[model samples]
Target chain A: SQQGEEDPQALSIQEGENATMNCSYKTSINNLQWYRQNSGRGLVHLILIRSNEREKHSGRLRVTLDTSKKSSSLLITASRAADTASYFCATAPSGGYNKLIFGAGTRLAVHP
Target chain B: DAGVTQSPTHLIKTRGQQVTLRCSPKSGHDTVSWYQQALGQGPQFIFQYYEEEERQRGNFPDRFSGHQFPNYSSELNVNALLLGDSALYLCASSGGTSGRAYNEQFFGPGTRLTVL
Candidate 1:
């Protein structure tokens, strides 16, 4: 079953602009992670935020989690053309931590 | 160190035939997980292996199964395949020592399966 659902199935933005994507999940999770997948390539781990963490940042990426609302958002600051890719949010259910249930990703196109 | 690596980058099989996809985990990693991603959709977890055992599994039926070798490599096998089974099969690896909150998964370029 799909655990997470990402909003704004697709987004287009110019370089240097900020891009944001939101995710909502059905059940409680131990942690939420964000990954980036280039065209026809594997997914790369980006950032992870625990249930207790309200927000976290890594370089140009900022992730916010609200366990109460079962929602999260990923923000990319100063988006670059290289940052264009499909971004997905995955949630590991509280009890089953080994497998991740992913969301339908948001495709972001950063035009240079 | 090499990241997760999968074999048979692309494969073609007919409905009702079986297929096997291989994966080698990153050095020093022991856990392996498999996922299926259909066109324009998110990946759905199939199962996971650790310590040469099936540690966890998702909602997939018995037709889908996997095995982990002593070397920490794994293979996903789909039996009695159906046309709807065609998708990109992904292999991911992560260390078991890292707690749930800190574990980071490394994924390999998925194997694109085309079921005719």
Candidate 2:
């Protein structure tokens, strides 16, 4: 079964605006990673935050993990039309680190 | 250096037929994993391979099987396919001491499989 669940099935925003997506999981995780997919193609690895990490940043991407709440959030600052895509949250379960479980995902549209 | 690679960018097959998808891991990687993504949904883990063994599997049935070659490349074989099996198949590879998924994974372009 899918371990992670995301909110805001879809989001639309203008360029230069910040977009945030949230994800919640049911089980404990060793790590949580985010990925972006364009159309229906391959997924592009984004930032990953360990269970112990509260926040991390890579360029305009910022991710936060709250283990206490079993949730994580991804924030894209100053969005661009090129940033339009589907974003997913994946978790490496504490019980089985070899299997990555993913959430449904959020479709983001950045309009110029 | 080249990243992970997969063959036959797209494929089409009929229900009840079988299909094989291949993947070559990135340089220095020895573990391969597979996932199935339905339209408008996140990718679901199918299985993971290491040392030419089926190390771990997901909720998929026995019909979904895979093998890892000595070279670290892998193949995912689906027998008696169903229409629901039609989806994008993704291959991911990582280099870890125990072939664990906790490490960052490099993904291939994925093969689009359509079942009629």
Candidate 3:
């Protein structure tokens, strides 16, 4: 399976704190993506990092990918209460049709 | 520029029954994919359709089938439903051309299925 396995299935932190989640996958990938889901609803895409890239960032999110280790991490700096949601890591295979295999996800709780 | 859309939002069914869920791809997107997400788990790919044909499928059983129309609208049909089938069904859309690499997927709100 090409599924990404997320670490720290759950995490709790105070507002303004940095929250980080890690994911490891079994096979090579073309890219790794992070998504946020609130209330088990539709997932909002956060970012995508290609295998050739080691790190990337969006407004408040920073992602690092280590293809040699087949692992990735997502860092949300100064998270707010509104940031509370389940975070998932999905991988697109290196040599296959674009079907993503997702991890169980990390449940994040940001307390005010 | 509408994103992916799915319906009905929710459904209830019993064992041995069949149900069909529908989806409309994002504007300009011609490929559609379906996923099943069990409680507390991430979404699992069921299948994908492009150009009104099944392009790829996951490990899902034949009981789960789908169709994609020329307009890029899609449907997921499940037969002989079981209790384990209860979950959130998600639809995603990407790619405007059949030869393009659709790496970025836009997801719909999803349809929640409850099996009795």
lDDT of 3 by residue, A13-103 (tens): 9999999999999988888989999998988889989999999999999999999899999999999999999999999887767788999
- On the 0 to 100 scale, the lDDT of residue A112 in model 1 is 94
Q: Is 1 or 3 the stronger prediction by lDDT?
A: 3
Supply the TM-score of chain A against the true chain A for every candidate structure: 0.98, 0.97, 0.97
For model 3 chain A, the run of ten residues with the poorest summed lDDT = A91-100
Cα deviation of B40 in candidate 3 (Å)?
0.4
lDDT score, candidate 1: 0.91
Per-residue C-alpha lDDT of model 1 across residues A52-108, encoded as one tens digit per residue: 899999999999999999999999999999999999999988888558999999999
Report residue B23 deviation for candidate 1 (angstroms).
0.5
lDDT of 2 at A20: 97
Tens digits of per-residue lDDT, candidate 3, B1-116, equal: 67889999999999999999999998988889899999999999999998889989999999999999988899999999999999999998878765348368889999999999
Predicted candidate 2 versus true structure: per-residue lDDT over B9-81, tens digit per residue: 9999999999999999999899999999999889999999989998788889999999999999999999999
**lDDT of model number 3:** 0.92
* Model 1 residue A86 CA deviation in Å: 0.6
How well is each residue in A1-112 modelled by candidate 2, as lDDT tens digits?
7889998899999999999999999988899999999999899999878888999999999999999999999999999999999999999888674568999999999999
Candidate 1 lDDT tens digits, B4-82: 9999999999999999999999998888999999988889999988888887888899999999999999999999999
